[model samples]
Target: MVTVKMLKPYYIKADNDFIRVILAYQYFSVLIDEQVYQFVPTEAKEIRINRRTQKVENMGVRFAFQKGKDIAYLTMSELISLPDFLLQLDTIAQPYYFQEKTNQKNETAIIIRELEQLNLRRLIDKSLDERDADTFHSLTKML
Candidate 1:
């Protein structure tokens, strides 16, 4: 029996349409019976995923799996039976997606704070121009 294990990608890049997993240096592994086969990327091959559907797009992409001197290329049929693996990969890539959202939130917060400060400064200026000592003091204290 074949059991897939240690299926990791070196890097995951996500965009609006797709998530690409760049494979490198023993990033994927599978166990066939008792032997552990490590699949290493020999050329430029990436697992392209549809961002909305979360489905693997490059089903024909193959990786050469090696166990000591024994080596073989994984077949398309075998690659097709990997929905669970893709789900695991999605979990691994979740933090990267969340990180982008977090950065956007932080940027929005910074802009809002800057606008509030600017408004307060304008109020302070108006109080100075009108010679309103109480309003000027209150606005400056808000700074």
Candidate 2:
């Protein structure tokens, strides 16, 4: 069995509530109001701040996350609440940088190997089509 390592936990305030985020390799979990929501990296597509009400007395701020087919929103009554909410969102997005870098390297290696195989196959086909016994024998030996 293989053991999986977990990333450090981070906490931030959303209005009167404090949310905790736990990161892992391909996914992350968020705890809000004693409830935990597990989210996949790809599922979280957007994060933004929304303003509600134009009147100065009734203005409110809403921080939201667009996750796959659903949206999770949290509202704040004070403008000072924006910073912490933004910070938490930034923390949630951090692990994807390392994960994407590793994924890109693996994808590039796979593409290169596939291209090499295609070139070899083409060379073998050409040799057979021309009835070149010496070239065909050499190419087959390389395989």
Candidate 3:
């Protein structure tokens, strides 16, 4: 039987589309039949998770564990059965999602403010060209 002993990511990277969990050397350990094994990335590969579906991408990521003179790879099925690992990953990814939402809101607010200013400038220009002192004065007061 396989059981997860510890699964702590070194750092997490998040964007609008995906969240990546990066593991440092010897950071992730598991137990197979009461024997402990530390899984290491074959390359600088990270576990990619889709933000929308909250599932592992599992396309190009590879992890290997040394078993004496032989090396074995951790399979996708083993990863999927670990509910605690998934929960921890989600907890770490949640803050990034919140920050992304906050940033998007700030960007939207800035755009709205800029559009409002442009509209006001156009109105002021039109009022000045039409020789309407009352309209121009009202628009200038908005500044």
TM-scores, all candidates, are: 0.57, 0.30, 0.57
**Model 2: lDDT of residue 88:** 48
Itemize residue pairs with steric clashes in candidate 1: none
* lDDT of each candidate versus the true structure: 0.75, 0.45, 0.75
Q: Candidate 1, residues 1-143: lDDT per residue as tens digits?
A: 67678878788887877788887767788887768988866643577877555566777767788888888677645765777665677776666453555577689999999999999999999999999999999899999
In terms of TM-score, which candidate is stronger, 1 or 2? 1
Rank by lDDT, descending?
Answer: 1, 3, 2
- Candidate 2, which segments miss by more than 4 Å at Cα? 1-97
Residue pairs with colliding backbones in model 3 are: none
Give the lowest summed-lDDT range of ten residues in model 1.
Answer: 93-102
Q: What is the lDDT of residue 107 in candidate 3?
A: 100
Q: How many backbone clashes does candidate 1 have?
A: 0
